[model samples]
Target: MKNLVFALFLLPTATVGSAGLAFGEDSRQLATLPPPAQEALREEMRDNLVALNEVLSLMVAGKVKEAGEVAEAKLGVSAMGKHRSKPMDARPGPHMPPAMHGIGMDGHKAASEFAAVAKTGDRDKALALLPNLTSACVACHFSYRIR
Candidate 1:
Protein backbone atom coordinates (compact mmCIF):
# COMPACT_ATOMS: atom_id res chain seq x y z
CA MET A 1 0.00 0.00 0.00
CA LYS A 2 2.88 2.34 0.72
CA ASN A 3 4.40 1.58 -2.66
CA LEU A 4 1.01 2.09 -4.25
CA VAL A 5 0.57 5.43 -2.56
CA PHE A 6 4.05 6.55 -3.63
CA ALA A 7 3.35 5.49 -7.21
CA LEU A 8 0.03 7.31 -7.20
CA PHE A 9 1.76 10.49 -6.07
CA LEU A 10 4.43 10.15 -8.76
CA LEU A 11 2.00 9.31 -11.54
CA PRO A 12 0.94 12.86 -12.19
CA THR A 13 4.49 14.22 -12.31
CA ALA A 14 5.54 11.37 -14.56
CA THR A 15 2.69 11.96 -16.98
CA VAL A 16 2.18 15.72 -16.95
CA GLY A 17 4.97 16.67 -19.32
CA SER A 18 4.46 13.82 -21.71
CA ALA A 19 0.71 14.33 -21.67
CA GLY A 20 1.17 18.00 -22.55
CA LEU A 21 3.58 17.18 -25.37
CA ALA A 22 1.48 14.42 -26.75
CA PHE A 23 -1.63 16.54 -26.66
CA GLY A 24 0.07 19.56 -28.28
CA GLU A 25 -0.08 23.10 -26.96
CA ASP A 26 -1.49 22.83 -23.41
CA SER A 27 -5.20 22.38 -23.71
CA ARG A 28 -5.91 23.23 -20.11
CA GLN A 29 -8.38 26.08 -19.64
CA LEU A 30 -6.77 29.45 -18.99
CA ALA A 31 -7.79 31.24 -15.83
CA THR A 32 -7.64 34.96 -16.39
CA LEU A 33 -6.91 37.10 -13.34
CA PRO A 34 -5.98 40.69 -12.60
CA PRO A 35 -2.22 41.13 -12.61
CA PRO A 36 -2.01 41.55 -8.85
CA ALA A 37 -4.21 38.56 -8.22
CA GLN A 38 -2.19 36.50 -10.67
CA GLU A 39 1.03 37.40 -8.94
CA ALA A 40 -0.47 36.70 -5.55
CA LEU A 41 -1.82 33.38 -6.71
CA ARG A 42 1.54 32.38 -8.18
CA GLU A 43 3.32 33.32 -4.99
CA GLU A 44 0.83 31.29 -2.96
CA MET A 45 1.38 28.32 -5.23
CA ARG A 46 5.14 28.55 -4.77
CA ASP A 47 4.66 28.67 -1.03
CA ASN A 48 2.37 25.66 -1.23
CA LEU A 49 5.02 23.68 -3.05
CA VAL A 50 7.52 24.56 -0.37
CA ALA A 51 5.08 23.57 2.33
CA LEU A 52 4.44 20.26 0.57
CA ASN A 53 8.15 19.50 0.60
CA GLU A 54 8.47 20.44 4.23
CA VAL A 55 5.55 18.19 5.17
CA LEU A 56 7.04 15.23 3.30
CA SER A 57 10.46 15.78 4.84
CA LEU A 58 9.00 16.00 8.32
CA MET A 59 6.98 12.85 7.78
CA VAL A 60 10.05 10.98 6.57
CA ALA A 61 11.99 12.18 9.62
CA GLY A 62 9.34 10.65 11.92
CA LYS A 63 8.18 14.04 13.12
CA VAL A 64 4.54 13.46 12.35
CA LYS A 65 3.20 16.09 14.73
CA GLU A 66 5.53 18.66 13.27
CA ALA A 67 4.38 17.69 9.81
CA GLY A 68 0.77 18.10 10.93
CA GLU A 69 1.49 21.54 12.31
CA VAL A 70 3.08 22.60 9.05
CA ALA A 71 0.17 21.25 7.04
CA GLU A 72 -2.40 23.11 9.12
CA ALA A 73 -0.44 26.33 9.04
CA LYS A 74 0.41 26.25 5.36
CA LEU A 75 -2.15 24.22 3.44
CA GLY A 76 -5.30 24.03 5.51
CA VAL A 77 -8.41 26.21 5.19
CA SER A 78 -6.92 28.71 7.63
CA ALA A 79 -4.34 29.55 5.02
CA MET A 80 -7.17 30.76 2.80
CA GLY A 81 -7.78 33.66 5.14
CA LYS A 82 -4.67 35.43 3.86
CA HIS A 83 -6.62 36.59 0.82
CA ARG A 84 -9.36 38.20 2.85
CA SER A 85 -7.45 41.45 3.20
CA LYS A 86 -6.99 41.80 -0.54
CA PRO A 87 -9.45 43.71 -2.66
CA MET A 88 -12.20 41.45 -3.93
CA ASP A 89 -10.94 41.69 -7.48
CA ALA A 90 -7.43 41.02 -6.32
CA ARG A 91 -8.27 37.75 -4.58
CA PRO A 92 -7.71 34.52 -6.46
CA GLY A 93 -10.90 32.87 -5.21
CA PRO A 94 -13.08 35.58 -6.66
CA HIS A 95 -11.36 35.25 -10.00
CA MET A 96 -11.34 31.49 -10.23
CA PRO A 97 -13.98 29.50 -12.07
CA PRO A 98 -16.31 27.67 -9.71
CA ALA A 99 -14.85 24.27 -10.55
CA MET A 100 -11.30 25.48 -10.13
CA HIS A 101 -12.13 27.13 -6.85
CA GLY A 102 -13.83 23.97 -5.67
CA ILE A 103 -10.73 21.95 -6.42
CA GLY A 104 -8.58 24.43 -4.55
CA MET A 105 -10.87 24.35 -1.55
CA ASP A 106 -10.94 20.59 -1.64
CA GLY A 107 -7.14 20.50 -1.60
CA HIS A 108 -7.05 22.67 1.49
CA LYS A 109 -9.68 20.52 3.15
CA ALA A 110 -7.64 17.44 2.33
CA ALA A 111 -4.63 18.98 3.97
CA SER A 112 -6.68 19.80 7.03
CA GLU A 113 -7.91 16.24 7.21
CA PHE A 114 -4.40 14.90 6.80
CA ALA A 115 -3.16 17.20 9.51
CA ALA A 116 -5.79 15.94 11.92
CA VAL A 117 -4.93 12.34 11.16
CA ALA A 118 -1.20 12.96 11.30
CA LYS A 119 -1.44 14.48 14.76
CA THR A 120 -2.63 11.13 16.05
CA GLY A 121 0.77 9.66 15.12
CA ASP A 122 -0.72 6.90 13.05
CA ARG A 123 1.83 6.59 10.31
CA ASP A 124 -0.11 4.13 8.19
CA LYS A 125 -3.30 6.15 8.31
CA ALA A 126 -1.48 9.36 7.55
CA LEU A 127 0.24 7.71 4.62
CA ALA A 128 -3.11 6.46 3.39
CA LEU A 129 -4.42 9.98 3.30
CA LEU A 130 -1.56 11.23 1.15
CA PRO A 131 -3.38 10.70 -2.14
CA ASN A 132 -6.42 12.57 -0.90
CA LEU A 133 -4.17 15.52 -0.10
CA THR A 134 -2.27 15.46 -3.41
CA SER A 135 -4.82 14.35 -5.98
CA ALA A 136 -6.64 17.65 -5.82
CA CYS A 137 -3.43 19.42 -6.80
CA VAL A 138 -2.88 16.99 -9.65
CA ALA A 139 -6.42 17.46 -10.90
CA CYS A 140 -6.39 21.24 -10.72
CA HIS A 141 -3.06 21.62 -12.45
CA PHE A 142 -4.11 19.25 -15.19
CA SER A 143 -7.41 21.06 -15.69
CA TYR A 144 -6.55 24.73 -15.37
CA ARG A 145 -3.73 27.26 -15.74
CA ILE A 146 -3.18 30.98 -15.22
CA ARG A 147 -2.78 33.13 -18.30
Candidate 2:
Protein backbone atom coordinates (compact mmCIF):
# COMPACT_ATOMS: atom_id res chain seq x y z
CA MET A 1 0.00 0.00 0.00
CA LYS A 2 2.84 2.39 0.77
CA ASN A 3 4.39 1.54 -2.56
CA LEU A 4 1.05 2.20 -4.19
CA VAL A 5 0.84 5.57 -2.54
CA PHE A 6 4.33 6.43 -3.68
CA ALA A 7 3.46 5.42 -7.22
CA LEU A 8 0.37 7.61 -7.09
CA PHE A 9 2.65 10.51 -6.19
CA LEU A 10 4.32 10.12 -9.57
CA LEU A 11 1.08 10.24 -11.57
CA PRO A 12 0.72 14.03 -11.69
CA THR A 13 3.97 14.56 -13.54
CA ALA A 14 2.97 12.05 -16.14
CA THR A 15 -0.15 14.09 -16.77
CA VAL A 16 1.34 17.54 -16.09
CA GLY A 17 1.05 19.58 -19.28
CA SER A 18 -2.40 18.12 -19.80
CA ALA A 19 -3.50 20.65 -17.28
CA GLY A 20 -3.05 24.22 -18.48
CA LEU A 21 -1.36 26.04 -15.57
CA ALA A 22 1.65 25.52 -13.33
CA PHE A 23 1.43 24.57 -9.65
CA GLY A 24 0.99 26.94 -6.69
CA GLU A 25 0.60 30.07 -8.85
CA ASP A 26 -2.72 31.00 -7.32
CA SER A 27 -1.47 30.52 -3.77
CA ARG A 28 1.81 32.24 -4.62
CA GLN A 29 -0.10 35.23 -5.93
CA LEU A 30 -2.12 35.25 -2.75
CA ALA A 31 1.13 35.04 -0.82
CA THR A 32 2.36 38.33 -2.32
CA LEU A 33 -0.35 40.40 -0.70
CA PRO A 34 0.26 42.41 2.51
CA PRO A 35 1.77 40.23 5.18
CA PRO A 36 -1.39 39.97 7.26
CA ALA A 37 -3.53 39.01 4.29
CA GLN A 38 -0.94 36.66 2.92
CA GLU A 39 -0.49 35.04 6.30
CA ALA A 40 -4.20 34.51 6.64
CA LEU A 41 -4.39 32.80 3.30
CA ARG A 42 -1.23 30.85 4.02
CA GLU A 43 -2.54 29.69 7.34
CA GLU A 44 -5.76 28.59 5.74
CA MET A 45 -3.95 26.74 3.01
CA ARG A 46 -1.53 25.16 5.46
CA ASP A 47 -4.38 23.95 7.60
CA ASN A 48 -6.07 22.47 4.58
CA LEU A 49 -2.88 20.71 3.55
CA VAL A 50 -2.37 19.31 7.04
CA ALA A 51 -5.90 18.04 7.03
CA LEU A 52 -5.32 16.49 3.64
CA ASN A 53 -2.23 14.69 4.88
CA GLU A 54 -4.07 13.38 7.86
CA VAL A 55 -6.97 12.22 5.77
CA LEU A 56 -4.67 10.47 3.35
CA SER A 57 -2.83 8.80 6.19
CA LEU A 58 -6.09 7.59 7.61
CA MET A 59 -7.24 6.35 4.21
CA VAL A 60 -4.00 4.44 3.78
CA ALA A 61 -4.51 2.88 7.15
CA GLY A 62 -8.09 1.94 6.19
CA LYS A 63 -9.67 4.38 8.59
CA VAL A 64 -12.37 5.32 6.15
CA LYS A 65 -14.96 7.18 8.20
CA GLU A 66 -12.43 9.29 10.08
CA ALA A 67 -10.67 10.25 6.86
CA GLY A 68 -13.93 11.22 5.26
CA GLU A 69 -14.81 13.43 8.20
CA VAL A 70 -11.49 15.21 8.04
CA ALA A 71 -11.84 15.76 4.32
CA GLU A 72 -15.25 17.28 4.83
CA ALA A 73 -13.93 19.49 7.61
CA LYS A 74 -10.80 20.57 5.81
CA LEU A 75 -10.05 20.04 2.10
CA GLY A 76 -13.59 20.26 0.79
CA VAL A 77 -14.27 23.54 2.53
CA SER A 78 -10.86 25.03 1.86
CA ALA A 79 -10.95 24.18 -1.83
CA MET A 80 -14.33 25.80 -2.19
CA GLY A 81 -13.05 28.92 -0.44
CA LYS A 82 -9.81 29.11 -2.38
CA HIS A 83 -11.56 28.45 -5.65
CA ARG A 84 -14.04 31.22 -4.95
CA SER A 85 -11.48 33.99 -4.21
CA LYS A 86 -10.83 35.48 -7.64
CA PRO A 87 -11.70 35.91 -11.26
CA MET A 88 -9.51 34.04 -13.74
CA ASP A 89 -7.55 37.10 -14.90
CA ALA A 90 -6.26 38.12 -11.50
CA ARG A 91 -2.64 37.54 -12.39
CA PRO A 92 0.29 38.49 -10.21
CA GLY A 93 2.22 41.75 -10.60
CA PRO A 94 5.70 42.07 -12.07
CA HIS A 95 7.21 42.30 -8.59
CA MET A 96 5.37 39.18 -7.54
CA PRO A 97 7.16 35.87 -7.76
CA PRO A 98 6.46 32.94 -10.06
CA ALA A 99 3.67 30.59 -8.98
CA MET A 100 2.11 27.20 -9.62
CA HIS A 101 -1.69 26.89 -9.70
CA GLY A 102 -2.14 23.24 -10.58
CA ILE A 103 -0.62 21.88 -7.42
CA GLY A 104 -2.92 23.87 -5.18
CA MET A 105 -6.01 22.65 -6.99
CA ASP A 106 -4.65 19.14 -7.27
CA GLY A 107 -4.16 18.90 -3.54
CA HIS A 108 -7.63 20.18 -2.90
CA LYS A 109 -9.14 17.90 -5.46
CA ALA A 110 -7.25 14.94 -4.09
CA ALA A 111 -8.55 15.52 -0.60
CA SER A 112 -12.09 15.87 -1.81
CA GLU A 113 -11.82 12.75 -3.93
CA PHE A 114 -10.21 10.79 -1.13
CA ALA A 115 -13.02 11.76 1.15
CA ALA A 116 -15.49 10.50 -1.39
CA VAL A 117 -13.67 7.21 -1.65
CA ALA A 118 -13.37 6.85 2.10
CA LYS A 119 -17.13 7.22 2.42
CA THR A 120 -17.35 4.09 0.29
CA GLY A 121 -14.74 2.11 2.23
CA ASP A 122 -12.86 1.33 -0.97
CA ARG A 123 -9.23 1.51 -0.02
CA ASP A 124 -8.05 0.27 -3.40
CA LYS A 125 -9.75 3.08 -5.24
CA ALA A 126 -8.50 5.58 -2.70
CA LEU A 127 -4.99 4.24 -3.06
CA ALA A 128 -5.30 4.42 -6.79
CA LEU A 129 -6.07 8.09 -6.62
CA LEU A 130 -3.03 8.82 -4.53
CA PRO A 131 -0.85 9.56 -7.54
CA ASN A 132 -3.00 12.45 -8.68
CA LEU A 133 -2.81 13.94 -5.21
CA THR A 134 0.94 13.53 -5.13
CA SER A 135 1.28 15.02 -8.57
CA ALA A 136 0.06 18.33 -7.21
CA CYS A 137 2.78 18.39 -4.59
CA VAL A 138 5.48 17.53 -7.08
CA ALA A 139 4.26 20.00 -9.67
CA CYS A 140 4.21 22.82 -7.14
CA HIS A 141 7.70 22.03 -5.90
CA PHE A 142 9.03 21.89 -9.43
CA SER A 143 7.43 25.15 -10.52
CA TYR A 144 7.30 27.50 -7.54
CA ARG A 145 9.73 29.60 -5.50
CA ILE A 146 7.71 28.91 -2.31
CA ARG A 147 9.04 31.87 -0.32
Candidate 1 accuracy as lDDT: 0.82
Model 1 scores a TM of 0.84
Query: What are the lDDT figures for the candidates, one per model?
Result: 0.82, 0.57
Highest lDDT scorer: 1
**Model 2 over residues 39-70: C-alpha lDDT tens digits?**
55567657757876897788777797787777
Stretches of candidate 2 off by over 4 Å are 1-31, 77-79, 82-99
lDDT of 1 by residue, 1-147 (tens): 233345456766767657747655767799998999998898999999999999999999999888888998999877877888989877888899998898888788889999999989888888888667677777788678997
Clashing pairs in 2: 8-131, 22-101, 23-100, 23-101, 24-100, 24-101, 25-99, 25-100, 25-101
Compare the candidates by TM-score and give the number of the best one: 1
Clash counts for all predictions: 0, 9
What is the Cα root-mean-square deviation between model 2 and the actual structure? 8.9
Among residues 3 or more apart in sequence or in different chains, the pairs in candidate 1 whose N, CA or C atoms overlap within 3 Å are none
